[model samples]
Target chain A: MRSLSVPSSPVRDLLALTSRPEVISFAGGLPAPELFDLDGLRAAADRALTRRTLQYAPTEGDADLREQVAARLTARGLPTRPDELLITTGSQQALTLVVTALLEPGSVVAVEEPTYLAALQCFHLAGARVVAVPGDERGIDPVALAEVVERDRPELLYLVPTFANPTGRTLDAERRAEVLRVAERSGLRVLEDDPYSELRYRGDAVPALAASSDLVLHLGTFSKIGAPGLRVGWLRAPEELMPALVVTKQAADLHTSAFDQAVVADYLRESDLDAHVRRLCATYRERRDALVGALAAVLPEGAVRTDPDGGMFVWVRLPGEVDAAVVLRRALERDVAFVPGASFYAGEPDRATMRLSFTTGAPEVIREGVRRLGEVL
Target chain B: MRSLSVPSSPVRDLLALTSRPEVISFAGGLPAPELFDLDGLRAAADRALTRRTLQYAPTEGDADLREQVAARLTARGLPTRPDELLITTGSQQALTLVVTALLEPGSVVAVEEPTYLAALQCFHLAGARVVAVPGDERGIDPVALAEVVERDRPELLYLVPTFANPTGRTLDAERRAEVLRVAERSGLRVLEDDPYSELRYRGDAVPALAASSDLVLHLGTFSKIGAPGLRVGWLRAPEELMPALVVTKQAADLHTSAFDQAVVADYLRESDLDAHVRRLCATYRERRDALVGALAAVLPEGAVRTDPDGGMFVWVRLPGEVDAAVVLRRALERDVAFVPGASFYAGEPDRATMRLSFTTGAPEVIREGVRRLGEVL
Candidate 1:
């Protein structure tokens, strides 16, 4: 048989470095299942198993679920209609649809430096050049973004305004408005990814960047709040973009699973998702405090760690000479794991930084893991 | 906000003309949901709910279901391993992974002239130009494929080997082997789409082209036999290609819904899927026969219809002057529907052809729809 050279994913090459069994991966931006509403999901699935719910549903999504999502977003102060919402396989697929519909080969997309790796991968696959804007713990630096927007004339900018992956930082409300204003002035559309917004452990809820920007494409998912197993997520875009997204989604997976949608809808209807969110906040806050306290106590002086108010991750910067990738291997030898900070950057990766997740392990496990990390250091 | 002009899907312009509610959509290659195993699905969902199977599962799929799918394939004389399979949101996403991982911008792909529209959409989205090879009712003509292979030196050939969409055509054993041989000699990879393979209403089972071609990436789905709403499908690729696919899938939706995968796995293990297939065949056979019989009785003198041994669709060609799109509008005006032929082609679609799906509606509905179509003619 002849050997045809198949093209490979640019992102896939990085995956092999992180796929070891002994690696306690903080690399994957996966929701910790210990925090999932398994009881509610079970009840919802039981309810959905009835004869009426087992058949094919509308390709758009189950009507009741779409309405619930819309209502929830409306309550969050965003103007949304049920018809405007599209349920997707995940927020990941939603991003894929956005990229597929709005991006062409060689299109310029401005993203946050050290943004979500998956989003970067999606844009790369869609044949877009990912131009990064410098961001801090408060999210995208409006001045830097404005400079890049004026310089590169990018078509879109992607950001996570609340508790971003790899860096558990939220963009402040002032910066949010500034970013929106800049986008309005510069003609750049923003893709506001807010999956970690609901998992906030401290402070009051902040309005999403989408609420402020008319040009924003808001992506949300149930993966963090409820269950990742269902792979249910939604996108709320402007009228002009919805049709294109629908068509792109139709060509992607027909639509998200109807069974999963129906079950999630049923779960939302009967359960107090807000209350579940509160419980998640309490538990994750405890875990977060444990890790932060342990790191402070165990790590050497000058090993800076991000003090995130909420979300699953903590970004840490080590001494300039200590590469995180090498540290990760040493930590694994001591039976601990984390994602190297270099994996998160679009262009110039930081070898001295790493991300630690507080959601996956228990408080006891967190302490032990940190102690092991201290020994490695 | 400034209107951003990103390059759109080339097929998007064509989609507007095709999505009219009044059009008899032979354009959408949707499975006949009437044949789905709703009872078994309901039972499985109920059982899974009781077992609390709504939590996150391994990214590959639920273990029992993978084992069951493997066992079932093995029973059919095809060797498979549970680890070798990756459950996808649908066969569409499965194909998307293959395209994303293998095709680069401007890569050459060979496809059937009248291919599955979604496959064309996928390849186009991946930034590859599709070269069409002429095909007859028995699937892609091997001699024509060989000629195209020699001329274009394409990277991949995509085909629907059994009960193909829009055509309801199956490749005989000899043709299957010949096509595999051609692919081997030419060093071309083949993507064998077999979603409709199990919906056969008559005749003995034909060996899959994958069994013959080691280069084949075989895709299977539960939509035709089980439920489209479940969105459960699997792709069997060679070991060398599996990692890239897994990485692509991880970037796509993390994985297909673990809840849905669990239910499907449980359903496949606990229920008699073969018995369900038998039931589907019996009902669909009647529906297919109804449309075939009605067309024989009512079609215009010069019109020709396919006599498919199995599958839900029957392709029909009208007289030279009659365009199927016009006929479709007229049929829908009379409260009937079918898809126009032009939507299926990757290049120039046949304006004189149309496809009628018999299994989506009842025999009486099928007869009435065909009668209205004939009247329009």
Candidate 2:
């Protein structure tokens, strides 16, 4: 118990490899720097600071940020009230709060075979027994999830249904409905982590699982859209969960940055988020295709790649018994980096798998990075 | 267990009461808004946003902020190394991380009998058995702490030695030394929470426990000096505890806001924090005296108050069997608000005690606010 850790996040380890100026990193799920609303955010920061907004905020968050977050979700077809939301440091903190409030030590938590690695870290730290439910290119398989619920009786099912981290897979509408039905019937809590839905380039936007299920705890973040630097996010949970979540959030950091929240609120109020997202979608879309096409053209014939419709990553299953660490080591020498997919699994992982993010680099850089990775392989 | 809260922080509850425009609130230990280095911070924000400082910072914090924090401590006689520190979302999170890393369920923690109420909540949520060591205006009794250490075999002792919350007490040099000696001898870790140390008004500053003891974990925050709304804080822990704390912080919020930290670093680099603090002290000192004098003139006989040298609140012990809740109810009727001291205790609390902050109001407002409370009494 003394050597306690929330498991070493191997994805962050992957990010460390990108320190050199020559490194074209596909390892981190960073947004394109060029797409950031820097000028707008600068003005927003100026507005926030001048209002003497440097005092402590309410534990829930600044009211305007809450309303802005609520409005954004409402625009995305999820009816949300300001009272129903709790602003978090990021969705990362919202995840931490939800788990701390809802899960006891050694509680059973079910997750997709490959899910957000950071969420896995949070669960592991809380001493939750995480059972992986098998998933495919289109997100977690509903039948497998049902089986896990039947066998393990998990208290919670954590999902990243729309453009999930690592996989970049969006759960189809039918699967979303079935999963929600299973959760509602079983009285199991479902966490709908939706950080990437709005960054879509091609596919039709699927309504969030939270929209359909009362059991769903929806997490949304400005990290991907506004700026990760501000560290702002929100959780839309059932009223029942609010008390515990609030208490947990209060202890975690007292509150997220009121100054940052005010800046975000100002930015959200004044700027065109949809237009900005569309631009991000366009930029990330080209980079996504470049990596997929490059991996297809460069890697061996037996290598399988999931061509994601949108979002940050392309999941690759390299041919044969290839070790990710070895490939990563070789890739680093050539100034190219991608996270080993083994890092995403709850237990035993496929050593052959890798996650390549396209959001951090240009299309040509993506092609070059992939070409370098192919040479290393 | 389901209604999990760190503890019910009445200070936050007090802030909620301040929403009414007519209420003269002395319930929260908030800073003077007018004293904030707003112009400097505005420039810092401009500089921060200009440098593309809107990216995920290193888990510990931005390098420059850590160095600045370290340098500030070095000036205060604590030889802090940049590597020894982990920047937190505020010292609140520093506490959360330290407890998460060091404590297990049912772990014994010895705290000052009316220590920070929110610390109790964090300990409670972590399932720690918080044993109280009796304290007075001179701060926690070191002899009582040693006795608790002997009988309870507690793993940690949490103290706010200088300008402690609720009591507005400063532990003397001899007491600080004795406490450190006992803690080191007992192999009990000491958490020296020092948010208000820099807000000195009347007395000479006390050197921190961490400066004298290797067993100490020091927490410092910019909230009291720089800005609470920014929510930046740091932990100076022994290298042995760094790993677990780092992991806990990573799982907690990934890291404190880089954008905020960068702004703070820039502000620290550019401005004189000492000058700002001196101004704060000058402002608060006058208000503090006003409240103390007003209470003397207005309160019923037998009411006792601590005339603090520094920090925010003045703890008042109301006459006889006066229920604090009742006094607060009546105080609200007169549009005067303060925290009933009953909210600060771990078990059954002192109903006759109250805490009033002089930091928020001007001298006239403080005098008027105290008069209204006197009328209510």
Candidate 3:
């Protein structure tokens, strides 16, 4: 018998090393736990623990939760209906479900060069061939995307277009339209994963790619805004794909946790999610500023980093010949950590790059973490 | 692009029809909602709603919950370590993880003739070729299992040994040993699904197959005893398989809900689960007797039925020339429902068979539902 043969994650292994309490680590993609609404969530759980909430729910999702999600998406400029969405364990499960519904083994998929590592792993587990579409400071390079699409004939193109993970790059309106045009011309489908859109600290929200094209599948998660421990997310797809996705979801796990879904729905109804998000943005923005300012002052003259408008990460490109992995080893010796960017690639390695997450620490703590990294460098 | 090609479940679709308030459905495999420990669970949730429980946790699972699950399994006769277990989203997700970890596309798997339908769908979704091993009254026939393994050269054997779905037959101790012997000789892996073992109303407990063989992967769930809405389950596997299973679990949904896991752990610590289960057994046993007795008094002469010692369902075979599906249509018209047993078979279906669940109603209500079913027949 043969197995799926997924490679052990280097990033996850590295994160484990940084988990020691003594280490000031920027290696994890986790939300700040201090920001969670404990009392609000506890109240929601109290109200939601009823006979209806304790029963097996529909495979699509809890209808009230779906309606709540749909309404929020519509308010954000993406017109959605409850029927168009399928609740998932997290947006991570949404990626797996999408792959199950849309791609087969050996089918070609295009992903951004250094995309979300978990998404790359999902595609590989499904036995799909991944082709990388190079990106620039402005996010995915439309010309490069077109070239890759023409060459590889990929069935699906995966993007994290709004305040993306690891890189924290947002595609401008013009760039998003150009990417969609390329996909449309090539008859390709796009999966727009927008988990960090609502985490924006400064910029106005951009319309989702799904709002403009029926071919795009949209994914959103409450992990960043509500709580990751709930494991709740949703996928919005075109009408044609829902049947297969629902069937695949039922086979995958029957459904996501009904009690969690009910609690989330009640929380949305009885609490101020917008106010909660604003508080998160206020704290995270300060942390981000601290990390970026500290990095600029310490790094060598040739080094460059993306100063994102929002999101959790600041992607840094070290000076020429300065390998990030080597730096990470030395940094670990000083109880400081960041992820070497090579682990996020779907194609060629970039050894002189790294990703730092600023969400888990305060401004002072983040500055302290970067100070330790500065000494290692 | 190609989808996984899993067919929509006929049973799930049939269940949607049975959901009307007027219908008395023995079609669902749902635990009684009133039996849930609402207050106890709410208290647990209140305590578990902490910063730790609201953040991303280890993909392997919460260490505390694993320790508790391990201790319970150890007390029940299977010696286990916390590290040997992986928490999943219900045991349903456990089936998907096992399929991903062990079976590649086109690998052969052996299952009982009329097995858990969802398991069949999961195997098929992974492109595995499933072959059915016929069973008699005492669960899977060891002789038939040996012949199928020898002929088909299946890599794995799946059995719901104690109080199985569709047919609540339990494997006797002698038959369990024989099945393990055949598996050992053939170098076959066995998946011992024991979801309903804790709900026993009569008979002595049988040792899990994992107790006797390291090759057996044991699956258990809190769905039956606690609540399915929590979607908490665990799988115990050999050390050789744990790495792949952990990796697969990470790729599946990062991990099961940390909030739910923490609540379940706290509930187990703070509440008396044995007493709750005993209460469930007492009620369900009376309902089972009522359903069985009613069927015996009403079914046509020559019809045969299984009087299960414990668990949710009782399988029935009507007299000659009967079609269970046709009877279901007539029964539904009278606001009474059951699952036609043909949907459970992996091989040829028996048109005369049907499955009735007794856990959803009181004894008087169960008798009334069966009386309506009698009129339709």
Candidate 4:
């Protein structure tokens, strides 16, 4: 009875390893502060300082904000209704609500190998066992996912189709269509977490898998583009699923902060969120390019790194003889940090792999951090 | 699978009954708009609109806000550490995190006969069966609670010991001690939810039940006194429970909005929150008096209402022949609304009971709403 019913994060115990202030972290998926639109926030705050903005808002969200989100989705070729969207504390709570409503104890869920640790945590807490499907640099392997679906008949499959965490891989359009087709055939509900879609550093915009499949639950967030401090995010699901999601949300946090929602709504209504997103893409691309170039110049010949089209991270594979955990410790002594690849795995940990975030620090800092890592190696 | 997993809210389902624009709603547990210090909010926004305020913050919350919460608790004689407190989206999220950690399938929980509906919803969603203990007008009856505890030995007992929802009842100091003793003897963790503690319309302040027992988890909110739009709340628990709550919160919403936390911390630091509380007390007291007076003049001779010292609601018992739900429907038809008693109870609802909220509307609105309700009756 003393033990919690929810499973505790094993990563928390290992948190002590990276807690020192001197540790220059690439471990966390934190957005760059310089990329945040501070001037826009100030302007938004000025608008929200009105008496009406301080009042309680509709639980669904402010209608104008929902419409803004809908418009953004529409621009991306995914038509959405205000009623189909539920604003959450963050995309994390969106997952929490979806999992709470759709999952039961011992329910089977399929996740990509080296998935987002936080999503894995949510699924584990909901009493679901995660089945890892083999994925490659091109994102989830459709054949492997189909095999798992045939074998386990999982209730749901979760994926970050664009700019995946810990891997920094995006599914090609053909793979996206195949994954959607397989899910539809197997009757699997797909949770498409797309927090990084707008942060694309290169390439043409890809249509969401949700646009191709009615069963897909699409998640979006303000964390990557704007500020994580606001904790504003949303989920778009089928109409049949909206009521349950709302109820689960009510049980979770009643609703996201109304004041934050109002500020965001005002910002979206009056400002150029797209232009802000363009700035994020431009700055992050430079940082990404710098990190990639620095790794090429500094790392040993056999070391390999992911070439991400967009988003914050660069997943690197070190020499098999050198464990990432060991490298992380040595790097931290040189005042640098990265997430060990093991933190992202559902079962089998890849000791030689690690995730480095390139978006949080400046290009010069990234170069210096990589040079230090090279020295440690 | 869809039907079994999603537990619908009966209250929210019935919200359509009072959805008309003309309705003077006593159904919502919202604070009055006039009571909001717009001037203070404007000042706070101005101060918090800087570049630093728009950046990401620690998941636990900003240090200054945590210090302010600790100070407020210390002044109340409840010793709290800044680390022990995790700022939540609201006290609602505080309860959600507690339930997510503590409850599993078939777990037994105890509640007052007519408890806060949201708590019941949360517990139910967490896969717990709530057993109601008979409570008198003064709050959870110590004798009945002890008997239920002896028989059931539930995992936790949730109660609003001060100015409780649906009942507007406060537990006396002696009863609070008795509850603590009973809980300790029975090994039942007590969740003391006290959102309305600062809204005392009359009498001196009573120490929270958490002050009497180390096992008690205290939930406090800024919604009643300051602004619900900010959605800031806190929980103080024993050291052992802090880790589990924090971990659960990490999965639920990452953390409450950091911007809101900074604004609240800034507001509290620069101004006397006590002064604002005094204003709320004065405004709400006038509204309460108006409702009480109107009920006396308009209600039937057999009608009875609790005389609450503080808080938003006044629980009323109409003639046994008159069903509150039916009367609520009639009242809504006449452009007035309230929560019917049936929504509050987990087992058999008292058909004669209803809850009238006095804090959201003005004195004139309250008077008119009560008159309309009386006319319908």
Candidate 5:
């Protein structure tokens, strides 16, 4: 039999490297284990593993979790109903299901240049033609997005509107409204991903375009806020899209774990998630400042890094003469690891750029890691 | 911009009905909740929710859980390595991954005449051309399978070799050998779904065909033996297919929950799973006998039922005039439920057939439920 072929995800391979004890890794966007509310989670799990929780749950997910998620959305000003939300294993599954259910083979889907690597992979796996629209530090370039959508005539535009992966960029409220108008005018669906908006340390919350636009599909996850090991996330789209997504989810996996959902729901009710998230923001802000602060002292010349308002990552563009992958190899020699930015782009890649996650390490570790990275350079 | 469309899975809707307390549900292939080793699982969960378990796990799975699974496989006469196993959200996800990695749009996949409805939905989602091969009481008809493979030249053959779904049919030693020989000679890849093999009540345990065949891709789950709510399952396949499968899984959801994996791994280590399964087998055996004994008295003159060697279901062909769907509708009025058989077929459906699961009820409940079903008939 002939072997089927698919490219290995560069980020996934980098995740494998983090297990090496010597490596101070910024390769994976993992949450800090020390910060997890384990005591709260244990109590939640204890209360949730009853007879009702042991049975198979609905395809959409546990009703209590869905309602809780909807309430969270409402708390953020994007009011939603339990029935309108589809619970997922994580936001990744929500994105994958949304893409799979909507896009067909050869269907064009426009994405921001150097976007979340996994989203690009999901779109590619759907057999969609991925068109890249250039973006600045703020977020997707609206002019570029409008032009690309008009020219490519893509079915959907995938965007990480708030605290985007790899870049840690957040679009302003005015730009979000403009993008929504553009999407409506261009007849393009917008996937508004907002996993890290809640982790803000130095910025006002920008309401999601999904709150105002019918064309936007909103995605949120508890991985950053609550516990990643629970593997809980949700998607809020228009009522019409739920059936197709639910059907696809049924085919993918009957449903996410019921007991896990119950545990998360229990935690949401009994624990101080708001305070816990605030604590996460406070800790991550220090780590982010330390890493960004070190970059200036470390880099030689012609290298620039984004100063994110809040999130897990800081994106750096290396000097033109140096390749990020090559630098990564050298950095590993000094036991520092970061993901090269080549894999995130839909079209021509920024081979001289890299993404460093500040989530796994503390301020001191971050400083030392950046110093080691500087030594390699 | 435009609304996408996808058909709802029939069984998914059917599963929704089982939540009503008044309904005696034989519709869902659920394990007996009372049989769930809750005390053991609690101890395991307590042991597992450490700092490491709260962090992200390898995409392949927990090394310890994989080793445990491999050891279990060895006990079944199919010695596997930890590297060969990939943990999934459930066995459903395993099937989805196998189909996603192996089959493309319009790829041919051979299935049994009446197979697991979810598998059919998965094949359809992959845009596959499914061809059904006829089967007898024991298992798939070898001659028919050979003809279909020659004609359809399918990329894969999905089988439930031990305790097949819907039919509750097991391939006898001779038939299994012949089927394996045919598969080898024809170069047909086999997906052996053996979720219910461990639940045997009154028969000799047949060594899996996967133990001998290189073409076989084996799937297993903890849902039946340990708990369904945990949503832990795994697959063992040739190394060649692992990369593509892993890539798809990465894009789907980073990985299964690390805490769930650790919990199951701890349970495997600390609990007497062998004794627990034996207890399950003994309990289910009585239920099976009650249901089978009642079915003979309940069904009409021409109706017939297959006595499963092991598994949750007893497949019954009702009287010619009675439609299974109609019977289901009527039975629900009397607070009893069984899945109609039509959706299980790839081609022409058996409208007069139905499947009753014996796993959810005890002997008394099974007898009473069956007698109530008889009244409706």
Candidate 6:
């Protein structure tokens, strides 16, 4: 049980090889460093470096930061009050807090078949019984979700409804409504992890599940748009759940760093975050096209990949019985790398699957990395 | 079980009253804001504002920061290596991680009576059985601890051996050895939470419990000396524990903020933390003296408080059956505040006990606040 908590995935082992500067790795879901607004953050730091910024803050979070996030979330179609939000180290921590607050040991949790790996780790740590709801192009299949919910009596249904990690698939608006209905009928709560919504390149934005349902615990992060290193994120939870979440959060880290929260709030007030996100979307859109176009041009005839409209990843399925780990090994020999999709799944893995991330590289660089991958294939 | 996790302590209730501008609050264990090295930190932040500072870092923590912490711990008597430590949000999170890594649900954890409130909260969150080992002013009694270990067979013995929070009592050198012997006899691991050793205002330092026992998981933090707002701390553990600790920490917050870690590293590198600590110690000494002297002169005959040599708090036992909450209400009316000590205990209430913090208020302000308490008495 102890060792199982630590990931020994072939993908993680292979990722170690991609650290060489020569490897134009499409492995990590890291945001483009060139896009981080250093000047704006520096100015924010200047404004935030007060005595109050160095003291212990309220357990809930910095009031002004919550207000800023509340305003932004409200502007984004989800009406949120400051008190309704809990600022976290990152949305990752927000997920951990939710799992801790809502689930008891051995409680059932239903997640997408191939969900975020770290979320799986959180559920694992909590001793949760995780059942995967099968899905296809439009994210979690509502029929399967309802079946899983009714059979397992899952306390929570976790989703990445928009541009999800690993998959880069947004649940279609129709499916989102169906999923909510399934949840409502089964009395299952949904955790909407929305880290990639703002990174959309081409698709029109869908209203978040939380926009229609208070039962949804909506999670968001500055890691994608602001800066990952700052490690600032938040969860907008139903008021009924706030007390337990607060208690769990307090037990977790007291609160997110006061200095980071203050700086983020100041940056939001002073800088053009919308413009910065627009620039990011523009660049990522190009990179996404480059990876998609390159994969289409190079891979074997039976090989298939998702041409995601937005977000970091492009999920791929290789020709019959082809192991992604074997492909990863060959790619690394050529100084190229990507994660084996098997690592992302909660249930039995499809050994033929792999994920390619596009956000870290320039379009040309991503094309070249895929070009090397084609040699391996 | 859910509501039990949320603290509804009368002290927390009364603390709201002390937030008014007129009140002089020693209710929180906050570091002195005036003492924060703003210029040094600003310079550090200036040096730390690289693209990497805003990018996601290794889950274990930044390499440079761990090395700096390793060096500091080595210099302070306990030999440490960078690899042996895991960087955390604060020692608070360190406690949480240790609990997650070591204890299972219903695992027995023996803590010093009137332990830090948040530590109890973490144990409660994990569903651990917490038993308090009774002690006097010299901290946890080794014989009583041995009895608890023999009878309860607690998997862990948690202590803040050096200048503990709330109590501010340092376990004497003799007792430290006895406790180590007790731990060895029982095969029980000790978590020495030593956040305040550097803030010592008087007396020669005792070697940390970690210095004598490899079984000790030593927790230290920058919150008191550097700044709480940064939320930086570390835990030094045995090699066997690192894998589980790292995994738990990764799931906790994806490592503490990368920017905060880098800035703290740069600050530690460029600045003389020892000299800053010395300056802090000097000032806190006077404040400690003022609170102690004032209490001696004015408190009614049966009232007693520890004359702590170091740390943030001074634990007091008011005259028999005089509820600390009742005293707090009267003191709040006088615009003064302290935490009622019953809140810190896990086993049973000590209605006559309370904790007064000397770190937050200046000597003159502390004396004035104590004078107001005298009026209420």
**Among all candidates shown, the one with the greatest TM-score:** 3
lDDT of 6 at A313: 94
Which number leads on lDDT?
Answer: 3
All candidates' TM-scores?
Answer: 0.91, 0.98, 0.99, 0.97, 0.98, 0.98
Query: Model 3: which residue pairs collide?
Result: none
Per-model B-chain TM-score: 0.91, 0.97, 0.98, 0.96, 0.98, 0.97
**Candidate 1 wrong stretches, greater than 4 Å:** A1-29, A50-59, B1-35, B49-59
lDDT score, residue B244, model 2? 81
DockQ of 5: 0.64
lDDT string, candidate 1, A316-347, tens digits: 98866678889887887887778788878988
Per-residue lDDT of model 6, residues B1-377, tens digit only: 13424654343355576679999987978889999999999999888988998998888889999999999999999999999999999888999999988888889999999888888878887889999999888889999998898899998988989888779999999999999999998789999999999988888999999999989999999998899999999999999888889888888888799999999999999999999999999999999999999999888898888999999889889887899889888898899988989888989889899899988788899999999998988
Clashing pairs in 4: none
lDDT measured at residue A113 in model 4 versus the true structure, 0 to 100: 95
In candidate 5, what are the lDDT values of residues B1-377, reduced to their tens digit?
22456678888778877879888888989898888888898888888887787776678888999999999889878889999999999899999989888888889999988999999999988889999999989789999998988888987989998888999999899988988888999888899998999988876899887888889999999998888888899999899889998988888888898888999999998889999999999988888898999889988888889999889999999876678999899999999999999999999998998998999897888888988898998
What is the per-residue lDDT of model 6 for residues A3-75, given as tens digits with 9 covering 90 to 100?
Answer: 4256543443555766799998888888999999999999998889889988888778899999999999999
Q: Ten consecutive residues with minimal summed lDDT in candidate 6 chain A?
A: A1-10
Say which prediction, candidate 3 or candidate 6, comes out ahead on TM-score.
Answer: 3
Leading candidate by DockQ = 3
lDDT of all predictions: 0.79, 0.87, 0.91, 0.84, 0.88, 0.89
Ten residues in sequence with the least summed lDDT for candidate 2 chain B:
B1-10
Interface RMSD, Å, model 3: 1.6
Clashes of each: 5, 2, 0, 0, 0, 0
The candidates' DockQ values read: 0.41, 0.65, 0.74, 0.61, 0.64, 0.65
Question: Which parts of model 5 are misplaced by more than 4 Å?
Answer: A1-3, B1-4
